[model samples]
Target: MQKEYTVTVYTEDRIGITNRITIIFTRRGINITSLTTAETEIPGVYKFIITVMSTREKLDKVVGQIEKLIEIHRAFVHEEDEVVYQELALYKISTKSLESGDIERLIRDHQARILTITADYFVIEKTGHQQELTDFIKKLEPYGLIEYSKSGRVAIVKWSRRFHEHLKELQASSEA
Candidate 1:
């Protein structure tokens, strides 16, 4: 059986690293649903958050292969419930729609905020899981949405001690 999984990888900053990491998934014929890469709290260390649909068995193997890369410091696979995640979405809607009774109602109901208002359109910003963000779109359609953009998922593993903490633990064990 196949289910969604988020694969998190920590690596050193280097050129062409994204391409190299993605090729691993491509060669395995696994379709990546989302990919986000950003620098970690420590400079020169980057984290890659990737989502895919696969069985636990397949994903475990994928993580192993990812860690085999010389640049990778660590890689782990997580089920959705094993992590905390969020995505951000922005919607641009015609200002005229605001005139329609209670546009404020939709905004409040979705817990979204108007990012900016202009002569033509106003932008609304929302952050949540994918389904929540998609739901906001349906609620906004009647208000004459002009544009929509969403950022890839960002997540943190639930059962984690900081990566640095883990490193310290390893060092302690080695010294003992």
Candidate 2:
């Protein structure tokens, strides 16, 4: 049976690394539902959290293939229930089309942050699950949406009290 999986990949920041990683999934016939990449706290390293659908066996193979990439430092699949996840979405609305009262009500109802405002448009930012953002977009579209951007899901497994020990182990292995 196919199950959804989110894999976190840590790799050296180099051109084409993302393409190489995604190509592995494409070759295996797995479609990526969401993929996000950003620089990690460790300088010159990038992290990717990719969401895909596949059986456990296929997911494992994908991770193993990612591990073999020259630029990749580590790759592992995270259990969804064991991780914290969030996504960011930003939408710009035409200020002339919506009344301030209605706009405030919508923002309050959705818990969105007012990012900026000009005479013509208002930019709002919201962060949460993908479903929340989708619903928000639906509600705001009628208000004359100008633009939008979404950061794909990013997640990290909850760390235990012995997290430092695990980090040390990872550092040692990487340095070896």
Candidate 3:
């Protein structure tokens, strides 16, 4: 089954860096579900968080391609359960379709903020995983959807050093 994979790329901050990364996806005939890039803590360095849907083999090939890029310093693929992740979603829903009290309860339950409100519609902002946001959409569907937007997954290793240690142990056990 095709599953979502989060790819993190660490690279030099230079012109066309984004284009170079996107080209890899394009060449592989993969579509990026979501992408976010920013400067890293270190000067002259940048980080990109890209979410894509593919099989395990495709994911591995994509990582290899990313690492081969001249500007990319490192590239890693993270399984959903192995990483800490979050997504920001903004949705405009029809207020007329829901009871005020029910809508208020949903807003509080999802920890969403109301950004704007019209007589018929209200914009709600939420932050969580893809599943959480998807569930929220289903619940609010009764209220009618006007528009929706979601930011890509931003993730980091949960037990960063532990992961490295586990790899080392596995290698040692295999070689013995």
lDDT of each: 0.88, 0.84, 0.82
Off by over 4 Å in 3: 94-99, 118-121, 159-176
lDDT of 3 by residue, 68-176 (tens): 9888877888888878888999999987855656787878977998998888888999999888998898887877888888988777766556544644565477679
- Model 2: residue 18 alpha-carbon error in angstroms: 1.4
- Candidate 2 vs candidate 3: the lDDT winner is 2
Cα lDDT over the full model 2: 0.84
Residue 153's lDDT in candidate 1: 88
TM-scores for the candidates: 0.92, 0.85, 0.76
For residues 75-171, what per-residue lDDT tens digits would candidate 2 score against the true structure?
8887678679999999999988656568778888888989888999989999999889988999998888989889889887575325435545666
**Cα misplacement distance, residue 103 of candidate 2 (Å):** 1.6
Sort by lDDT, best first: what order? 1, 2, 3
Q: Output the worst ten-in-a-row residue range by lDDT, candidate 1.
A: 166-175
Worst 10 residues of 2 by lDDT: 159-168
